[model samples]
Target: MDGGVFANLMHGFSVALQPSVLAYAFAGCVIGTLVGMLPGLGPLAGISLLLPATFGLNPIIAIVLLAGVYYGAMYGGSTTSILMRIPGEAASVMTCIDGYAMTQRGRAGPALAIAAIGSFVAGTLSVVALMFLAPTLASFALRFGPPEYTGLLLMGLFVLAYMSGGSMLKTLAMAAVGLLLGMIGIDAMSGYTRFSYDVIELADGIGIVPVAVGLFGLSEILLTAGQPTPPAIQRPTLRQLIPSLEEIKLSVGPISRGSLIGFLIGIIPGSAHIISSFVSYGIERRMSTHPERFGKGAIEGVAGPESANNSAATGAFVPMLALGIPTGPITAVMLAAIMVHGISPGPMLITQQPDLFWGFVASMYVGNVVLLILNLPLVGLFVYLLRIPYSYLYPAILCFCILGVYSVSNSVVDVWIMLGMGAFGYVLRKTGFEPAPIALGLILSPMLELSVRQSLAMSGGSYGIFFERPIAITMFAAAGVLILLGLKPLLFKRKDWREKVGLEDQV
Candidate 1:
């Protein structure tokens, strides 16, 4: 590494090692693991719920805590998937296929051990990659103009919709709805209110916090209320937690490949963790000497997907921190959190807020160590949490959600927005519509509109400016390809489209 990069990292460690920052990191890790173990509450909900509580803290400390929660949840998700056959998050869905099978065969210990170890390896490696790549990407992004940004945002939305494992048309429609909702407040250029209906609260755009908490947190409680409880789990002894030497030898290849695949895929805009896990599972199955062993009790299956999921989670931060563009719903929430702290995340973020940027990066390394310790020795405690009845759990979660949303601006209006959005989200869930694209669209819409308007103003209202810039042209071309690829199934009426997209028979 360069001396400057090394120097910044050393300074970051100095900040992250402070007593208060360590406490925050520890607290975030614990809360994240608990939330990840709970069904219907993933990183998105976990981060959104805690966002209001961070308003009183320093921006660096707040982000460090939130970032810890983000990856800590990734670790916890595997625990539920293995012990109870319940995926705590969508990215852990592949883990259920093999992780539970290993548990059934009395190999739960090795599976859990391999998962923690692989995640540690991937998480640490990805953080190193982030430290180097984010700075380089930010420098490159400084060259971008309004037209380039317009094309990039447009492509980002399209890529997210394309990769989202649902109906393309539905996802596109949801993005459109989000864009319209984003335009509700006063126009930035004309200083005129568009859709506020003269409500004073509507003078500013809808708050992202309430909308996120409502859609992902409150709505989840309502949706999961009717689901059957998870099955009982048997805890493994400490002796059983250690994997055999042969199993360790078998896992190294899959874990390494999974890390590389996940990190690369995560740099793209979409649900990369979910996609990466599926990809890792497929690669392991194909490369296995005895493919028939998969879905029956394969250690490689458990190791590969878990590692990919964690690595991809780390990779998702690259775009958000460097380019100020969120790749998925979770990163969008993080973007909002950073903005709420009066810090704009973009090319200048590293130079202007090196302490915040590098300190947050250093915290990830510390957080990974914390997660390994938590997952290895305390795995049994998390399993016990799953036994709690949903009847009692849902009510508590609802109360927390209400309080968190209400606390944002201390306004009942925000609470109502949350509840209204919760009902809407629940309805959308029942109708097979994914809420992720809508969230991404809502977050990116203002930036999209501003970039387009700015480009138009600079080009004398000409539509050809997008094509005139090489970078913009490249981004638009990529967007066109993604849109076409997303529509291929409908156009060709392919029966195996889901399989091709890695969504076939997924739980």
Candidate 2:
């Protein structure tokens, strides 16, 4: 290890291992596990629901708590997926196929054990990668000026919109709306508010906290409430927690491949944890000698996807910490929390705030170990948590969301804003729109606007600056390519669309 990197990491462990920090880290993990095992609440909601409470916390500690929730939820999701055919979060959805199949075949123990172990391995490795990669990236990013930043942020948004599942057009539409909404507050360079009407609440702009909690958290609650409650869970005994040597041997390759895949994909901007999980599952299924064993309690199914999701979840930190970009909803909320605590995130953050940077990194390692320890021996306890009915749980969560958002600004207006956004979110959900692009758009809008305006100002009101810089041109070109690639199917789909329309009409 380089002296500089090693020194920063040591300082990080020193802060992270302190008794108070450790206690809060433990609490965050426990809270994450509790919320995560619930059918609907994912890390995004979990972080959003708890954000307002961090108003009084130290920046590093607040991040330690919230960051713990992020990855802890990743680990927690597999429990219900394996036991009850319920996915604790979006990433866990892939696990439900073979995980539930294993439960039916009375091999849930092996599945659960492999998932926990794989998550630990991947989580640890990814954090180490993050520790190394982020600093190097930040060093490289030091050369970025406003025009370069403008192009990069633009690239990020387009790449995110294109990679988000479903119609790229729909995702871009949501992103544009989100960016417009994010522009409601103030023009940083011009000192003028762009979209806020005469309303008092809109003056400082929409709070990301209220919007996030409402859009992802409350909307999910409303959607789940509209459906019938899930069936009762079937509990598995702890005595069967042991995985056979054969099972462990079978899992090794998937875990290794999944970890690498997840880490690489996680660095990209969009649905990475979920994407990595699905991709790993596909790869594992294809690589299997006994391909037919898949979807029928194949251990590789659980091992690969679970590891990939965790690794990807950890890999997402790279961009956020290094370049001040959010790759997904989880990082969006984390960015919100850090910014709310009055810390600016960017390439300079590593040098400007090494403690916060490395401390949070070290804390992730601690949180990973903490989750692994808690998840295994306490499997029975988590299974009991799954048995708790959504009937009773949703109401309490609804109340919590209300209280959390209200606490953000101590304003009833924020609460109303939250409810309004929640309704809008439900509409989006029902209509097949992904909320992630919107979340990214909303969080990143101000930065995007700032960069563009700054670039324009530097160019003396000319648009040519974006094209003049080699880096800026490359970024814009990359975004353009992604857009073209996304449109490629549509460019050739006239006959296919007609065939589908004809087939649907016959149906």
Candidate 3:
């Protein structure tokens, strides 16, 4: 409503609505769907490989394309998950639970249809939330000082720890490692480089794109190399792809609730689509009258978690745009991309850089439409992607990742760093640890230090600063309770027991 802000926004829409940007948006969606339809290659890797190409593009055009890729992958991932039982990314893993089951039972069409619809509904709903809520949220966040940020960071770390895979001690160690990795760049206050290792390549610090792609993409290829290739998918026809009206009616409530839950969790740092999907699945199962139907190809199972995952992907954009915080690893890559183009995502970004923000927002609407068109009619095309031999697919993914790493500032050193991280990621995978927390820590490192130091300075080096602020105190307390609950064997053990009981009954 402010004159300057309104004017800037109008300019942003002008750029976003341009015919050329729309074409790039469509191209990004198409590429995303293709990569997402494949099992090993994911958006992070795809974007990493493409980042070098975008270097020559206008910042707005580049981001519009990348954002489209991001969400289109979300849509495409569900396709492979439902039809082939292989998740395109970590978040889509939950979709495999019921989706693959539906495929086995010859319900692949309805399953894919439901997922596509749920993703569209959730993505649109979250975008609407972003349109109206981002400025408001940024205004509210302006009140935050050092104590609040510290509290928020602490909460982020704990949430990641709780949500990470088995072995709390190992997860803690991984997180510490991530926090230390985050300390690699220069110390903000003193202007001292803490862990540069006398290397010039590190002076600008490690790029999140190479690190993320290495961890998630390369490690995935290595992991899949040892496992048996997934079973082939039986293609579904157009008639099979369309869900009945009754199925749509049944899914509406879950899709709506999932959008809300996914969006809220996504705004918090360290929360990712995986966490949202799992939580959404649990909630949907509990609320369903026939909870037993969940693992038995329940329509709600396919709808709720897919919607939540996609919505969470959309919601993760909010904090990145408003608070200058990268909520997850993928967005961390996007943040790095923005900064690499000499732009920062922060509070002033909205007013000073409304063209970038609103252009990106408008492009999302166009991207959603593009995704539906590319994903739906071409559902068969995407399914065909699953038919590619693992031998060929894995190598292509590796080659792309290698090229992506080598392309970063044309530094061979980054390639070495990427390989090192890939090996480390493989180890973590073998040990049942999720790479996401490491990615979270790597991205949050600089922010964490800034907050910690600022809070200390504000409190004259007193540690009690974190406890003094009400919002900070509340979030930390909630984090503490969740940590205790996570460590305790009660809820998860009970839930596992119940699931076992349910499985036995079916047997």
Candidate 4:
């Protein structure tokens, strides 16, 4: 099996390294970076838009280009998060928490550089995993039935809520709000509207773009509006752009952990790439000696989540290539492109269309290297955007963000919705409530609801199915462990408690 895998991967390189294929891959990376950095357009939108152009190209070339865009956006989105306190896309939302904090603390260069480096390492590592472990992981992923999804997603939410630095109640409340907002659109399983309230715009529910832009970017602008001295941007020195050896040392653990976490989580379909970053962030905070530094510009916060995001993006290819199941929106589009070319996806795909499968796998290597090359050289230049006067810069960013939001649906209502969300976010921040969980809830709630509904329906409304299934039982048990671990810190909060309880704290 090892020999056969190596031979197939070598064959894939032969196809991917061709001049035309490499050219398309480069173009895709460039386009993906631009799309991801831009306010409204994400990798999914970028892929959807460019998909038609690939219609005339060979299926392999088309997938290569789209694949490049998919992961390239993961790299590009971090720039917005670190530089502007805005998420370029949903996956970068967590990046904004620490990445932007680093910028305010004059560590923008280190943040950007670490994000890029971590992304490269993780992307490369995930490809290796994809190359070697696709079949086994794909089979493992198949064990996640509706009941399993219910348990896993529940555990995920519980773990994240438990790991938050703020009040768990506040986080859960925000998440509940997110879940409510997510359910606004008409039901997909049953064509019934729950919260549209006769508003046509709400019929499709709120877009994550508008909500995210409003919550992070617009709210930021509003916060800056109140500051009398808005001189926050600074030009980083060449020395500063390069991370110190100590900082690099801090990132090693996070990057390696993120890569593994992202790849494993990425196997589960439906927003797994986005979810991987959040999961990584929680894990990092839990593991860090200085858990308190998490939202305070900790390099680990940036490194871990960014690495996880890119790797998860890479990891998403596993199921599609091995099992014909699209793991996320981007892979779904890529699969559509492949099927349009009359290529069937599934278990036999590797045997029947080894060229497509292996070549697609190999192209990831080329794409990750290309993205790293594209990103590193531009890090210093991106940091310079902060040097611009906040007076001029804020309005420009605001316009781009608004335009990005509006462009998604061509609806002015979304712009208004974004502004409203921004104001709400500002209020939340003032009230010491975190808005990040809200975004996660909005994104994951629908999937969770669908899984729970399916699981219940299958068991005729018996909740015991979640406990009866072995995988589901494992997930619930994991959630239970996370809960107890989360309680450990609280139970030993006294000054002398750590010595007694063995709870490690970063000095």
Candidate 5:
């Protein structure tokens, strides 16, 4: 690292290690872990809820706490995915396929350990990359016009659909539905409502929390409720929690590859963690010598996706800190937190507010270590949660889901929306439709629409603007390639796409 950058980082460490800052970081980590462990609650909700509390604090302290929550939640989400079939966050969904499979096969200890270890390594590495890359990348992103953003968002969605392990047609269809739903609120350019039905709540469009909670959390509950008793868990002893030499050897390559993939994707706008995890899982599956064992119980499956998710979380900070752009919902909240503290995050933030920028970066390194220490010993505790009877557990989960949705905006309308989505999700899943693509579509649709409208306005309604820009052309070409590759299965129909792609089989 440059001497100046190294000096700034050392100063940041000095600031972060203060008693008050350390206390806030520790508190944030604990609260974030608890929030992430619960279904329906994620970094978005956790940061939003605590945002009010940080109003009285200094910017650095507040950011330290909030940043801790952001990455800490990533760590906690893996525990739920591995112990139960539930993913605590959207990014953890890929982990569930092989993580729970490993649990069922009495390797839960190794899986959990690998996830924690891999997350630590990836998180730290991403922070290092973020420190060096953010300024350079931010400068490059200054050239991005609306046309470029439009292409980037479109490419991201296409890539997600292509990587999603199911029928590409079905995934694209779900994305279409999501786009329609995302259009329900008022149009930014026209200032006219599209699908609000004159309801005040609908004016802001649907809350992602409701949709995510309903589709993944409540639908899983309803599906599991209809099943037979869960299998008895094989609890591993303390010694077994540590991975064997051979298992570590198998995981190292995946961990390294996943970290790189995740950091690169995370710098893009939207929820890159979900895409990163899915992409990592796909890459690991393809690269494995025993590809057939992937969905069954592959250690690389658990390690790669988990590492990617955490690394992606760290990478998200680059845009928010360096460019004042919120990559996803969680960072959007963090942006709000910074603004509330009378600080605007942008290109000048590092120069004008060096302490806040570097201190936040330093806190990440501390938070990652804290999470590793916190999560390792608690692996057994989380696994023990799976022992509770479904009859008792499902009801509690239902209550928590309801509470979480309501808490988002204190709107009963949100709760109703969640329930409606839950029912829709259950039916959709029964029909072999995955909810993930719809969620992604919902999240990206508004941004895509706005970008398109802006691009057209800049081009005086001309269609040639997208192709004229080099970055836009590159992104569009990438999107086209992904779309064609995704459609290859439909064109050929040579095998069951689900089996060919290692999609999760219905339990």
Candidate 6:
């Protein structure tokens, strides 16, 4: 609400209004839609492949393009999930529950329309939230000591363990593995090589780009190759794409609730987007007057989760832009790109780098408009992409995955590591394990280590220092409660049942 903030933000609109930048934003959204429509591609993969191309752009322009692709892909992912029952990304999985069900029941058009509207609603609201809340949030983040951050990180990891939609033991195991992988580099403080395994390649540790692309993209290629060919999906008509007033009415409340849930979840350091979508879906069903209609093509079921995931994606940016801390792999790459350009993101970024901050924020609004324009007319086009043969798609997907990985350092060694990771990723997926928690752990591990080291330095190595701070103590207690509550299977099982019953009532 400060005059300066408003003025700077207005200045940002001036920059974002450029014809060239708007074109780039449009291009990014188009590319993102193509990638998101593909079963084996996700936002991370799409962004990685495009990173090198953005080097010539101004920081704001570059980030705007990247952000456009990020949000655009999220919109496109739902099309595939709804039409083909093949999610373009992990976050789109929740959409499949109701979206594909609607498809089978001949309501694919309505489902897609609702998702698009919901995303637009949620995205606009989240950006509005960012505009009002970001400065305040950044100011509060400035108050966090290393101990507080460390405590928060632990709390985040625990949230990931339960929120990941897998067995508690399995999620924990993945987190442990991810944390160890994260440690495989030169120690920042002692300058000691902890897990380099006598290999110089790991001296700088595994780059997140290669790791993410390998684990999600290449691995998905291998999995797709192994699966039987699926039937071709047909595109729905534009007329079918528009939702009824009653349907829109039914979805409004859920979308609003979803955005709220997603925004809150995304502020924490984890894969909150994916988890928040499912959580939103669950809530929508529970809150519905007729819960039993949920799995049978309920409009609320698709609207809430779709809106939630996109909103959460937007929310994830707040931490990265305001705190200089990457909360996930996508944002981690964005942070790296910013740093590579010799600009560090932090609390003072808004005041110190007004153009960079405001342009980025304003461009989000532009990106949303671009996404809505691209998605509304092109829903059928994206659905048509679902018909591309997997055999043909996998090769391109893998090649781009490799190209994306290699572009990070121009290292073939990274490609080799990526292949190995692909194998590992495939195995894990085959074994019913989720890769999101691992990715989350990878991003958070360094933060956790740095926080611990700084906290130790602050408290002169006192072990009790983490608990002494009121904020830290509160976070720790919240984490404990989350863990305990998450473990009560009977409780969640009952909750799930109640949600189902609630959905039935809405019908």
lDDT for model 4 comes to 0.78
Worst 10 residues of 1 by lDDT: 496-505
TM-score of each: 0.94, 0.92, 0.92, 0.68, 0.84, 0.94
- The residue-by-residue lDDT of candidate 6 on 1-507, one tens digit each, is 346767867988987888988888888889888888787789999999888877777777788888888888889888888888888887888888889889898888899988988998998899888877777778888889888888878887887776665576788788888888899889888899988888788898888888888888888888777588776685777888888899999998989998999998887777777878878887887677787787788888899989998899889888888888777889988887777788978887766777777888888888888788777777766666667788788888888898888887888878988888888999999999877778778777887899998899888989799889998999989899977766676555644232333422321
C-alpha lDDT of candidate 5 relative to the true structure: 0.80
Best-to-worst lDDT order: 1, 2, 6, 5, 3, 4
Off by over 4 Å in 2: 289-292, 493-507
Reference-based lDDT, each prediction: 0.85, 0.83, 0.80, 0.78, 0.80, 0.82
Quote model 3's TM-score: 0.92
**Backbone clashes (count) for model 2:** 0
* Per-residue C-alpha lDDT of model 1 across residues 1-507, encoded as one tens digit per residue: 235888989989999999999999998998888888776677877887788788788998898898888889989999989988877877888998889999999999999999999999999999999999999999999989999999988887787677666788898898888788788888888999888888778778787767877887777788778688766787877788999999999999989998998898888777788878988887788789987788888899999998998999999999889998887777877777788889988888988898898999999999999999999988887777878887877887788777777776777888898898899899999999977667767777888899999999999999899999899999999999988888777889875344653336543
**Model 5, which residues run further than 4 Å from truth?**
1-3, 35-67, 80-108, 226-238, 268-271, 290-298, 319-356, 381-388, 492-507
Find the 10 residues in a row with the least total lDDT in model 6.
498-507
Report the lDDT of model 2 for residue 42: 74
Question: Which runs in model 6 stand beyond 4 Å of their true positions?
Answer: 1-5, 490-507
Show pairs that collide, candidate 1: none
What is candidate 4's lDDT per residue for 61-81, written digit by digit as tens?
999999999899899999878
lDDT tens string, model 3, 1-507?
A: 365545645765687789989999999998888777766678888787778788888888888888888888888889878877788877788788889898999989988988988998899889888877788778888888877877777787787676543455666677788888878867778888878989987877777776787788888888887578778777888888888788788799889988998888788877478778877787788788889788878888889888998899889999899888888777876776788789977766776677788888878877887787777777887677678778877887788888887886799888888888888899988887767777778888888888888889889989898888898888889789867866665544643322322322321
Error (Å) of candidate 3 at residue 85 is 0.8
Instruction: Please name the candidate that would achieve the greatest lDDT relative to the true structure.
Output: 1
**10 residues in a row with least lDDT, candidate 2:** 498-507
Candidate 6 accuracy as TM-score:
0.94
Cα lDDT of model 5 by residue, 398-482, tens digit:
8877876787678899889888888999999999997876776776787789889999999999979999999999999999998
